[model samples]
Target chain A: MKAKIGWTTNRLHSFAGITISLVALFCIPLLGSSYYDFLFSLALIYSMWALGYNFLLGYTGLLSFGHGAFFGLGAYTVAILVTKFSFKPFLPVIGIAVLATAFLGAVIGYLCVRYTEVYFALLTLAFSMFFYALVFKLYYWTGGSDGIGIRPPDLFGLRFSAIEYPAHYYYITLAFFLISVYIGWRIVNSPFGKALQAIRDNPLKAEAIGIPVRRYKWYAFIISTAYSGLAGALYAPLFGHVVPDLFHFLFAGEVLFATLLGGYTIFLGPIVGGIVFTVAKRYITAVTIYWPLVLGALLVAVTLFFPQGIVGTTYSLLRRKIGIKGGE
Target chain B: MLSGVIRPTHGKIYFMNKDITGLSPHKIVKMGVTRGFQLLCICSNLTTLDNVRIAILSHMGRIGRVFSPIDRDREAYEKALETLKTFGLDKKRNLLARDLPHGDKKLLDVAMAFALEPKLILLDEPTSGVSTSEKGKIMGTIEKVIREKGITALIVEHDMDVVFSYSDRILVMHEGRLIADGKPEEIKSDKKIESILLGVG
Candidate 1:
């Protein structure tokens, strides 16, 4: 336990940091670079996805290589609702997607949460691939390999024109991103979150001390996949497309890579990683066809030198050098 | 077997008037049969107080509260402090459990189980890894806690001295079959028990 810091020091420090970050995010689209706004919106979506992933990676200590299934599940649900079913409401479509993905997450998590390490990761991978196969085979409903296009649904009857939709969508994604961060922060600081960490540190010990290790892992799995679903739904209109590749293991690896790059342990690590990785990948691909090689090398470098990822290492260094208040 | 770590092949497990046979470890613990392992198994990264607070929180049914911050739970904090104080570990509550000395680590493990408010605690070699000089003090603290709380303690120990000193009744098992069940004095005076455990045949 840290020496009890003053209320002003503890609360004000994190509060001010959050305010500044939120303000910066709220104003990203106003920079007059429409292209930058588009990239930032994509980055924001991935950030939310990575934030979900962190629940498993950072707190619950489950390494899932199949979260792309939830993200893809979300994207396809919204795409199907819009294109096939002709659903028009924004919130309800996302709501249904969240509920559906959470349902699937619950089933899969119940099975996978009982295992750990490679077994847990592999089990999640199997389920994700199973989901990918399901969507790919149902060509009439899911568009199969042809994928599906998304028509931006009405936002409470105030529909934006094509020219302004991108800018408006940025704000919407930012709003959800802010909410996700706040809730994520709150959940991690809660007793449930501490219990998850305890399970991660020592499941046998956690069980002996009365923490239901497997059940809590399942809970974390549901929470994370729901967030993934939400991120995927939010991403549909932004990308204007849903594809089966989103559910593939490779895409899951990308999400995992971004999370590790940003700093999975620190609260905001995955968010930063998501933003940087998405934006960096876009630029890197445009620059070279050898993008995979470059990215793979970066992943290796980060894993070797910065195991805590970028934010975690920097937070520790700052705390050590200047004794700055990073966080608990 | 009583804590439901493994199923008992031959008998039922009735804890506090409930059939808790083959229940999950957490459910068994929730029913008031908490356990401590032979090895130190506290959540080592967390502070000593937080480790105890987690058990207290579980006992209080606050482990599932997602909205409330862990540190703000006054009842859990105070109760955890009380459990720590019982083992004389409150002074080192600020330190991480893994960083504690060997004896204190053993003490903290039992303290966490105590925090769960177990009606019956099953301790496996509670003083196993501690120095011989500190073993008596650790056992004394644990004995005091069990006595004060009126907890039915089932301590598994291999130390002859600890067994002779602490036990009221003794059961001797040879080759996985119970050979003796009686008061410690009776077991001490039994020729069969002396032949088996004491190797005085």
Candidate 2:
């Protein structure tokens, strides 16, 4: 219901803003080093996942710690199809990935959304760890901790290898990222999005107003996981490997951290947060083996000083400086 | 228990000749019964119109439409607009719920309940924090809307004057028990009810 800025002057500003950034993304592969392009592609993938994560954490106010399971499932689906069967079709693979995770998400979300706050978080964590163990311990089909490998295949019958693949995949990642953002924008601007925000703001009130809060959450969970799965599917080809680590709770924590860092309330926060995190992690790991310590310290700083998150704080400051009259 | 916000330890709830005991709040709403909170429960981040629009969307089961723009649901949007107009909130439709005054916030809460178009509504302290001068007006608006829509309501209020004036039938509670249930006149004349309400035992 924070619809004051939607599709108005605020909407046009954001539309133009995202368009400019996306246009910049189109130039990254042509202008930047392959390493930079690869890293940017990875950031884009993370943005997709973070956007999905925001649906629960930001919009619906349900914090999940098990989304890595969906991510892993997506990776595993692509890995299984491409490696085991040598499947080449890209769209079907994405479809399978989304469907698989949505099924899993629905089952898990049904159980988890019955609780709120810490209970919900713990439940999602428990379920995610369950998947981590499932993939880790299942040595036969999953190849144990070794995971499975994938290759950059012909996308819609247009083949590209090592040198050409980065650009091709970058474009692919960009396309999907744009699609995901468009879908998310449409969703949050819709009445469904309003209801989810309402539930986030006040679950009791949402229920009294006839929102089937749990059911809405279940649907949100499925949609969110489907997006995570799409990101995961994209991730597998980008890295050319699908490991059990993808399922690990640690990866789930990373997704959570990125969303939090970005400011969950702001529309573009997670995407910007993902890029920042990717850049920061890259530089930090190069200099120190204790990257976690550096990252943790940074997180603490952000929490202490910028609780609205990077994008959210920046937006608020900009609005205040410009004298725009609206509460975030 | 009837609205299913709370479960009775040792009793069954029936609505429209069906047992609704232990049904969830949503199920109760689906059965055409709804409730409003004692506190300001409207979504603070949304516009006044959006607060009601969300209720309408939930009622229509269109909250699952992820692809279509909600504004494109022009019929529903216009209906919500009309609803806001009825509540005199149309002029402030674009304003966020949190920005509304205390009296208006309370009105928005009632507006959301009305959006559900329920057969019956349970209002918990509908006028709790409004200024003394505005309480009657708020209640008046609610009663007028409810009567106009032909909806039944069970309101929990502490103000005896408002209760006597507004309610067609009355139920009084004391120490977690129903002390009296009857016409307002009958309640005023009852000795035990008088003793408890007026401290004139």
Candidate 3:
């Protein structure tokens, strides 16, 4: 009986917590500066990306070091469509980008997910670098490292100038980000999510329980990479360009680091991590020329002290005190 | 040999008159055979109930549900509860599996295998970590549940008393070769068993 109170209150507190974040997110446009819109837009995109990526790593127990390939693929597809073919309107481009990434992700994930630990990581890394090299070498089409500049697509025939793009794009990103969160929540609390978590916990046992472990991991990998593609699709118009650098292994590492920083165990941990990484990286670079050094030091500190990441550690501490537990 | 965790070098395993040789563990499980490890294999971080619930959900072909909240699946939870009630772990259903005592962890491991509702259950040291006093109780429960469900149990046990008391038939193997196969009383009186296994002349 007493435990029920604790669980209910914990659920209420959890509900309150996510609601507060949504409220904060919904009001960003009210601040209204182009810079605020742009910065928060990137943060929201990254958060959505991390949430999607976490399905493969956090829930499904597959560590992918090649996700940047899909992200870049999405961006490149959108950029090429807009810049070369003069593809108008926002929605179809993103849909196409998502499809492109999902199609490729399904291929790559099938081969990669069956391998555990280091083998899986290396194979994904290899695939990502291959994509990076392909774009880099195909200078004419991809525009190489110089990249292709992107013009904002018309929003269903409502043309918006570059000056007005940031604010409008921020709102679009916010909507998609909210949708991603809801979808992520639905997934993690579902039976499919339970099997993925079980696979993460014990593959042998999961299989013994009649779960097709390999197939489920592959599904998660496809879903995760598809998310990266969506984030990339959103990113290109905001940044006004797409580059082969987006597929670099370093970029994949950064995404992984950010997710870990927020704590992969909690559902919102990666979002927090993504937001913190984007905002902090910008400020840190502005403060010092050796920003990589600062970020590296921060990573070391976080790894040593807050290994569970911010939300994970805080949630656990809260649970310890209040008899609350389970994934946030 | 049955659930295909390890491939048999030279023999076929027939379950319900189907060729199940070298099939994947999940495939074998799908064919109505479940195996529990001697080493506890339950998801340690999840609640005790959830540990069993995974098997029940999988058995019910609900593991692929993407839009449904598992917590809202009252039927799954009820089934999980019933499985726990059989193993006497229902009271600790909310506690994390890792927090369970060694004996209870073993119980959870076996409990998960049984949750599959398989036609045959292969238990590898199901009571190895259990306390002396609790061993008989757990074995009694295991027997009762298996009998009630009409599932055949193939148990690998080091405890001679448990082997003697529980098994209707006994197969004695020495160095990968079957030496004796008979009813418990028949095997107990075999000369090779008397000389080699029991260390009695």
Clashing pairs in 2: A1-B46, A2-B46
Q: Write the per-residue lDDT of candidate 2 for residues B67-171, one digit (tens) a residue.
A: 787878987888899888878889998788988999999989988888888998889899998888999889989999999999999999888878999999999
The residue-by-residue lDDT of candidate 2 on A223-260, one tens digit each, is 89998999998888888888898887788888888887
True contacts kept of 3: 0.82
The deviation in Å at residue B123 for candidate 1 is 0.3
> How do all models score by TM-score?
0.92, 0.93, 0.95
Candidate 3: interface RMSD equals 1.8
Error at B174, model 2, angstroms: 3.0
lDDT of 2: 0.84
lDDT of 3 by residue, A1-328 (tens): 1112226656676567767777898788789688888889999888988888899888877788898899999999999999889996789999999999999999999889879999999999999999999999998789998999988888878776445767777888999988888888888878898888889889989999999989999999999989999999988988888888899988988889889999887677898899988988888988999999999999999989998998888777876998665643
Candidate ranking (TM-score, best to worst): 3, 2, 1
Candidate 3's residue-wise lDDT over B1-201, tens digit each? 678878999979898999999999899998899998888798886778888998999999998998887889999999999999999999999888888888788888889999999999999878887788989987898888888989999988767788888998888777768888889899777877867776621
Q: Enumerate the candidates' DockQ scores in order.
A: 0.63, 0.67, 0.72
Which residue pairs overlap in candidate 1's backbone? none
TM-score of 3: 0.95
lDDT of each: 0.86, 0.84, 0.86
Q: Pick the winner on DockQ between candidates 1 and 3.
A: 3
Docking quality of model 1: it rates as medium
Model 3 lDDT, residue B184, Cα: 89
Give stretches of model 2 more than 4 Å off: A1-7, A162-164, A325-328
